[model samples]
Target: MTTIRTVTGHDSAGASTIISHGPLPGCEEFIHSPGFSAALVWRTPPQARIVDHPGDPAQAESVIPAPGGSSALLVTFPPDDLAGGADFDPLAAAEELCQRLPGLGERFEAEAPGFHRTDTIDYGVVLDGEITLELDDGRTSMLRQGDIVVQMGTRHAWRNRGNTPARLLFVLIGAQRPPRGD
Candidate 1:
């Protein structure tokens, strides 16, 4: 867990102060595979924009209602997780997430080849190790530390090719698809 410091305005002081500093509140950790895990860092509800304030301290506890919302998460993929070997269960992790997060279950399709698309613009940064991002078109890219990917509602999957666990920080923001027949 990462320590999150929250700063807010001090009454009658006209200065900002650290009101809270510690691990994220209400953070949920999910172990998908043997070495793969995901932690929900925070989430913002829809229907309005954030105001100029410290925001909700318990906001992290709110589960994402749907795809058209904002969320930040940390995902770790273990090596050989996507190799499709005898030990690897490809759908096990997805199924687990789908069961826990209703939004994920809504996007997942039974017939898809482990490839799913979401109505969100995802900004993913490789925090450690290396990972391969594969798209539905068979194109793939190897991302290392400091690499950033702008995933625009694309159908994709992640695989860790390195011996170490690959950690990625993703900030997904809600997006609306273009109207049909345009």
Candidate 2:
């Protein structure tokens, strides 16, 4: 028979040391810009939904109740709500934001602008500047402001290819697995 030992930190580390934590708190980031802002919230439990947009550089958002888990919402502040502390929308409110400027894709860098492929499904809406898109399937498209592109499970990237620094209110929705304990 083989013998093994299981060590317990509470008894060994003494009173001053905190052995292990039961659970940890999740984190998120809020992006604020001159004309737009975004809030990102994560869940402690596993992810459940995947608004698949493969190869597209943009992310997605949702409010479905996660089974046996919780989710965070990242909202963008609206223009009118500025003084009164603008209201935020995960994406529903972010849809028509870039109606005035031209668009290319999700990410449009000033230097060396081209395709930056991704692993999951993605969605993009152009807010400003012109965009140039090239896909893995040799399909290409251009988006002006106020256009929405849904890319599900394919390789893709974006290029501003313009003189200005364009902004696309991005939302990334990914695959959500069940919690480890679940």
Candidate 3:
């Protein structure tokens, strides 16, 4: 699936213009994980300043934005059964994930499959198919197309139980983790 992203900016004459209009450079379909794909749409550093031409901020070294920063991501999840098939090579899959997702790939727990936590507040919207949000304690919430979720900084996993693929858009805002007692 191709996701075209259009970026607007000011021209040399200080007039608004279309800076870019094409698929994101960071978009990729996971070869190891069949039916899975992701696109890093855009990113902004802390206290991002507006510029006539901000250039392409879609390429990222890490999915976790710096404090006061933000990132927009589009992800498609395959059915749970498609994961770790008989021909699935764990090492290859890990390498592919690391290469495609960078810092976000390393966040998944090795001991617990699909479970990971980040120091950010994520606003997620289900774009297609259905999905289930599984929390640390086995709690689950079903989400369908048009559904939205405000995910705090909590350990969670996404599960696609249905046969069809699930697509979601997430906007993550970097935040500082509070003290344990707080």
Best candidate, lDDT: 3
lDDT of 2 at 163: 50
Clashes of 1: 0
Clashes of each: 0, 19, 0
lDDT by residue (63-128, candidate 1, tens digit) is 342446787777777787443456655578667766555465457655764567777899999999
Better of 2 and 3 by lDDT: 3
Query: Which of candidates 1 and 3 is the stronger one according to lDDT?
Result: 3
| TM-score (C-alpha) between model 3 and the true structure | 0.95
Ranking by lDDT: 3, 1, 2
- Model 2: per-residue Cα lDDT over 71-152, one tens digit each: 3322222232241235544342223222211121233332432344332344567766656666766677877677877765
- Please provide, for model 3 over 19-109, each residue's C-alpha lDDT reduced to its tens digit, 9 standing for 90 to 100: 8898776557688888888878888999988898876765578978987999898999999998768998877887887788777889888
Poorest 10 consecutive residues by lDDT, candidate 1: 57-66
Which whole-number lDDT from 0 to 100 does residue 73 have in model 2?
A: 29
lDDT score of residue 113 within candidate 3: 80
